[model samples]
Target: MKNNLRGKIREFLASEDGKVSVKAPLTLGVVTGGIFLAQAIIGPTSATACPCQHDWQCPNPPHICSVGTCIGG
Candidate 1:
């Protein structure tokens, strides 16, 4: 029984249908990789400063903590 199952599995793997199944994951991987690479290259659109509790906690000078965010005017 095990040998029969193994033979069927081997036959499936050797078929063109198996090759088609492999392409979907490969395409998805490529697209996912491209998105990551684009993000790495382009970076975030806006700087996201850490939430601030005090004015001193803000990284930039002349910036104040208001509503948990740093604002510079």
Candidate 2:
């Protein structure tokens, strides 16, 4: 069993595709994709800023109040 494990490790280390140089890119891509997927799943509902003031308030709960008007921002 030990020899089999050692052989596998040696084969991984000696081969070009099994080496860290080749695997690092694939690992990085997988990690980056996972981060993006998590962000997409748990990201903020609105992608804009919601401004407010003391006197006036936004008509819409989440709509932004800019220049005394409500727009997407």
Candidate 3:
């Protein structure tokens, strides 16, 4: 019984064909990486001031938060 099991195991291991699938996620990865990189580069482009005092003082459109106050548009 042991010998038979060993042979079977050997045969299975030595099989010529098996399930080997290759997937291409390059496009997805590129798009995702691009979006993330863009966000990282341009996402924090707020116009607020460095040391803001009030809401109306910071930059407009994209309110940037500085050390202690909100920047204006």
- Backbone clashes under 3 angstroms, per model: 0, 0, 9
Overlapping backbone residue pairs in candidate 2 total: 0
lDDT of 3 by residue, 1-73 (tens): 9999999866655564311211235556788999999988886655543566665556565775566776445
Rank the candidate models, highest lDDT first.
Answer: 1, 2, 3
Q: In model 3, which regions exceed 4 Å deviation?
A: 1-24, 45-73
Best by TM-score: 1
- Model 2 alpha-carbon drift over 4 Å, by segment: 1-17, 45-73
Question: Which is the winner by lDDT between candidate 1 and candidate 3?
Answer: 1
User: Per-residue lDDT tens digits of candidate 2, residues 7-60?
Assistant: 998888778867667578888999999999998898765433345552235545
Which consecutive 10 residues in model 3 have the weakest lDDT in total?
16-25
Model 2, CA-based lDDT: 0.68
Report the lDDT tens digits of candidate 1 across residue range 1-73: 9999999988876788865787667889999999999989987654455577888776577888899988896
What TM-score does model 1 achieve against the real structure? 0.41
Candidate 3: residue 39 Cα off by (Å): 0.1
- TM-scores of the candidates in the order shown: 0.41, 0.39, 0.29
- Angstrom error of the Cα, residue 43, model 1: value is 1.4
Off by over 4 Å in 1: 1-16, 47-73
